[model samples]
Target: MSAIITVENVGKKYRLRHQKTETYATLRDTIVRGAKNVFSFNKVDKPTVEEFWALKNVNFEINQGDRIGIIGRNGAGKSTLLKILSRVVHPTEGRITMEGKIASLLEVGTGFHPELSGRENIYLNGVILGMTRKEIQKKFDEIVAFSEIDKFLDTPVKRYSSGMFVRLAFSVAVHMEPDILIVDEVLAVGDAQFQKKSAAKMESISKDEGRTILFVSHNMPAMEKLCPTSIYLEHGTVKKIGKTEEIVNEYLIATNAQ
Candidate 1:
């Protein structure tokens, strides 16, 4: 099968400012500092700007119906890469080509309207994911059932707890049935049973419906079980991409060596 997603020389750059002061400053301190800086002739207190690359020269290809795991330690550019793929942010360098509709659940309340009712947000999120009203209506019942938040269906999403938010968001994203699903570690907020159910659902969609999935998680066992092929990222770069078991092993060895 041809590749459904291609990432070529992808990189994301961010600016970091280092201030010559206490890391945490109160409002009063900030105001006083600003006044002093404005009146003083010296620029020694000015923050130094530096460029930080969250991702660098990352290249990968994902085939249709593939379940791929992205594993790494904190600050490995995992979230940045996902945001780039989901079009939430643009890469500073290189380009990405995607062949199908994509739905992403990168955070608890991502793509959700906190002021809208759960029922309303379902339609909203579905529409955002490229589904028609009829399509969303067709799967609305299933989404509610999967989320198990039927009682709160008409309640504003702002009233939801983190777990509830995740359930509703995950439910909507999956039920919309986008061609490509990009999931970050937000699922870790759910209960164990819910996580298991979600894993099974993702596996089913990829295996039975031929959808492509990119999963990022720190849960090793879950990652191993759900993804046959995996990419190991370290320090904003791809360290290895191969069978999940081998990659996980290598990552673990390196992590333990540190």
Candidate 2:
């Protein structure tokens, strides 16, 4: 099978500011400083700026119909990598090549109009995913049923609980039938039953429909069950890419030793 996505030397850089801490000064010292500032050139303290690489020199290729799990500890750049893949953010020093329409659920309410009703947002998300009105309409009923938010269909999504928001968002993304599906830890907000249902759905899509999936989650069992291959990330770099069980074991051992 051909590779559906290729990431080459991908890196994302961010600038972080650190406030300078001032030592305690007496009232007299403060008055003298103020007087000096009034008579002399006004000097302002600037926060220290540091360049932080959220991801650096990351390279990977995902074949079509691959169910790949991205595993990492906090601040490992998993989310940043996903954002880059989904085109929510751009890499600073590398390139990515993708060959499919992508539907992503990176956050609970991503790609959703908070003020719009669930029914409206479904159509909006589908259209954004490159579906036409007729195509979205054809899948509308299935989306609503999967979401199990029928009673709230006409209600504004801003009023929805996080669980409801994820349900509706996942429902729309999956029903739109994109060739690549990207999901992050936002699914953890849903109930266990819902999470299980979502895993099953993702599995079905990848196996039966030949869709590619990139999943990121802290839930180890779920990740192992859903992904045949996995990538372990640490400190903004790829640590390993191989069988899910081996990667998961290595990650757990390293995490425990820390």
Candidate 3:
């Protein structure tokens, strides 16, 4: 099988405002901004910006039927790289070639309308993740069953507890069945039982269904259980790329250096 995803010399840069205070100068700033928008919306230029590279010269290939873990410390660009691949943010340089439907769970409860009922939001999230109405309908019952929120399905997500919201959102994401699934550290929420079930679901998606999964998580035991190969990132660069054991061991060594 050909590579399902190829990332070649990819780089992402973010221009950071030197002073974040200027972005939200004061409560009056919003009124001024609103008035400016009512007019021609002329750009007000005052804040200085510094370019920061979030991902640099990052090249990797993801074959079909692979579950790849992305492990890195905080501020190491793991989240930024996932956002780039998910199209939430565009990369500043290089090229990425993907040959399948892609769904990204960058964060739990993403792309949801808070005012929508859980059932309605499920359909909406499924559609946004590239599922057809027919497919979503087919999996509707299963999604609800897995989420364990049948009773609250009719309630607006804004009224649901945070835990309930995450459960429903996670269920929708898993049921969409995209060929390439990208997840970013969303296993932190939910009860322990749901977390275990979600892990099993992800493992099945990779091992049984032969999907390509790029998982970013700080949970070492869960990462070890799900990913046999991984990429370790450090300071916006690829620190190591190999077996999960190898990369994780290297990460341990590097962390101990502190």
Candidate 4:
């Protein structure tokens, strides 16, 4: 398999937000403070901001037909790396090179239109995921059938049971047939059955269809079953990268120690 994605010296920075209590009741009071801050050296005249690097000097490459799992504790930059790969956020430094169409399910209902019916949202999501309207039309039935939302297709997604909404969202995302797929732990929605189905579909898409998949999940057993490779991140860095068994064991042991 050839290199489908390459990430070089990638880093992400985020400003620490300090929410100041508002003392003014109206715009005039705020304006007065702003004017005073322009020439004043007093500490109260200016607000201070702090910044931190989320990901630093991160680098990796993924080949075609690879199913890699991203495993880490919370705030470990797993999602941050996925966001960069999905183009949801740009790195503060370095770059990413992508060779094929990429579709990401970073969250459930990410591209869904709440007011629209499930049916309408399907087409909308498909188009947003880079499919043409005609392409969506061609896969319309398959999408609905796979989602099992045929009966409630025309009902607004806002009215859907959480499971129905997740089904519709996951179905639309995975059906895009992109050469590269990035999935976060969005299968937490719906029931156990839906999670199983989604995992199966992802497995077939990556393992059988020769696509590259980057998966993030806390379910170690599921990761073992579905993914062949694992990348363990700790403190915003790749701690270990190798066969799923060894990497997952490292993740579990480290997390338990913590």
Give per-model TM-scores: 0.86, 0.85, 0.87, 0.90
lDDT of 3 by residue, 157-224 (tens): 89999889999999999988889999999877799999999999999988899999999998988888
- Candidate 3 clashing pairs, residues 3+ apart or interchain: none
Put down candidate 1 lDDT per residue, 137-230, tens digits, no spaces.
9999999999999999999999998788888888887887889999998657689999889889989999999999999999999899999999
Tens digits of per-residue lDDT, candidate 4, 1-258, equal: 668999899999987645473643368756766888776778364545578888888888889999999988999999999999999898999988999788888887667988999888988888877888987888888889889989998899899988888888888888888899999998666788988898888999987899999999988999998888888887788777899998888877877887
Pitting candidate 1 against candidate 2, the one with the higher lDDT is: 1
Model 1 Cα RMSD, Å?
3.6
Best of the candidates, lDDT = 1
Worst 10 residues of 1 by lDDT: 16-25
How does candidate 3 score on lDDT? 0.89
Please list the C-alpha lDDT of all candidates, in the order they appear. Answer: 0.90, 0.88, 0.89, 0.85
Q: Give the distance in Å from residue 117's predicted Cα in candidate 2 to where it truly belongs.
A: 2.5
Residue 225 Cα positional deviation in candidate 3, in Å, after optimal superposition: 0.7
- As for TM-score, the candidate ahead, 2 or 3, is 3
Candidate 4, overall lDDT? 0.85
Give model 2's clash tally.
Answer: 0
Each candidate's root-mean-square deviation in Å? Answer: 3.6, 5.6, 5.0, 2.8
Where is model 4 more than 4 Å wrong at Cα?
A: 18-34
How well is each residue in 1-258 modelled by candidate 2, as lDDT tens digits? 778999999999998766543455468766765777677774443346789999999999999999999999999999999999989897899989999788787765556899999999988877876678998999899999999999999999999998899899887777778899898876565798998888788899999999999999999998999999999999999999999999999999999999
